[model samples]
Target: MAENMFLFWGSGSIPCWKPMIVLEEKGFGGYKNKFITFSNKEHKGEDVLKLNPRGQVPTFKDGDIVVNESNAICEYLECTYKDKGTQLIPTDKAKRARVLQRMHEAAANMQQKLVLDLLYYFFQTKEEDRKEEEVAKKVEAAIEELDRWEAYLGETKAFVAGPDFSMADVWFYPIIAQSIRMGLDLGKFPNMKAYYDKVTARPSVQKSWPPHWKEEPPMISPFKGRI
Candidate 1:
C-alpha cells in the first residue's frame, strides 16, 4: 500500500517519538518514516528546512498539509484519521478533557522541568566542574514532581488519563522512557513502574522505541553523586 503520510524524525528524540507512536496506534503501518541524524545535522539540511524552517524533527507531511511540533502532529493525526484506527482521544467529554490536561502537563511541566533541566545539567556540565548543591536541588524537585504523577497513577489504576489509552499516554511515555535512559529510578514510583511496564509492553511503543538505545549503555545521571 502507498504511504498516506511522511514523518521526518530523529532516533531517540522524545518529541519525534510522540507522533510515531500516534501513527502506530492509528495502525497506519505503511506510512513512511525518514530517519534524520543530529550528528550530521541532516534535519538542518534543505529538504527538512524547507518543510520546517526551524529544521526540527517530527516535521509531518500529509499531502500538502504540513505540521510541526510533536503534540500538534499527534492532534492532527487524531483528528484527521479519527475513524480509521485506534481512537487516541477519548470520546467521552470528561475523559477527553482529562487526556488533554495530562498531555499539556506532560509537556509544560514534566518535560520542561524534569527532562530538559536534567539534560542541561548532564550535557552542559562536566562531572568535575558540576555544582553539587544546585544540581541536587533540581534533581530533588524533578523527583517530587514525578512523585505527584505516581500518586495520580496509583489513584487512576489504568493508563495516564484513565482506564483507556489516550493522548496523555502518548505524551507521557517517551519522556519517562528517556528519563529511564538517563537513570531516573522508576522503582521509586511503584504505580509509575507498573504503568511503565504496561505501556512498554504495547506493540506501538515497542515499535517506536529508540533504535540507538538498544546499542548504547544507560546514560549515567549527572546527579548520580549528589542523589
Candidate 2:
C-alpha cells in the first residue's frame, strides 16, 4: 500500500469527518492527516486551494492524485485500498446496490434538510432576530426527513444500510451526531437514538469526533422546544 496520503480537514465539518472516519477504519496507516482551522481560513490557502479549487476541507491527496468531495474520498479509499482495510461498500451485488442507494438517499433526503434547511437558520441568523414561525417551519421539514430515516433504521437494525457497518453509516453518523449536539431530541426517534449510541461507541467514530466538540460546550439547537 502507498503512504504519504494527505488529508486536509476541518474539525466539526460532517463532510470532513467522513474521510477521517474512513481513514481510521482503514487502520490509519498509509495516510497523514493535516487538520485545518475554519476560523483561520487555512482551507482557503494556496496548498488546499491547489488541491481543491473549492478550498474545502477534506481535500485528499494521494501522491499526485487529489480527491476533494468527502463521499468521493471515502469511495476512493474503499476502491484503492480495498485489500488494506475493512470492506466498506460490501461485496455482495444486491447488498452493494442497497448500501449505495441508502448512502445517497441519506445525503440527499436527510443531510440537506438537517444541515441546509434547519441548521443553516441558526448559523446565519441571530436568535434575537430569528422569526419564530420561520424556524418552526424549517424544524418541521427537518423532522419529516428524520422520521423517514428513523423508520429505515428501525427496519435495518444493525446499521444504516443493513447488518454491516458500511459506507452509509460512515456518511450518516457525523451529521446525526451534530444533529443531537445541536439539541435534536434523539428520544423522538427511538431507533435513531439507539443507533447513535451504538455508532458513537465504535473506536473509529469516537476517535474521529470533532476535537472542538469535546473541549467546548455543544451548540444549542435553534428549534429547542418547538420541534
lDDT of 2 by residue, 124-171 (tens): 888798888887788888888888888888898878899889899988
- List candidate 2 segments past 4 Å from native: none
Regions more than 4 Å wrong, model 1 = 218-220, 223-227
TM-score of 2: 0.94
lDDT of 1 by residue, 1-227 (tens): 21858989999898999999888899876788689999899999898999999989989888788999888999999998888678999878988899899999888888876778876677778878877687878888887788889988987998888888888999998988888777676766899989999999999999888999999785566534432
Q: In TM-score terms, which candidate is top?
A: 1
Q: Residue 59 of model 1: what lDDT?
A: 92
Candidate 1 positional error at 173, Å = 0.8
Q: Model-by-model lDDT, in order?
A: 0.85, 0.85
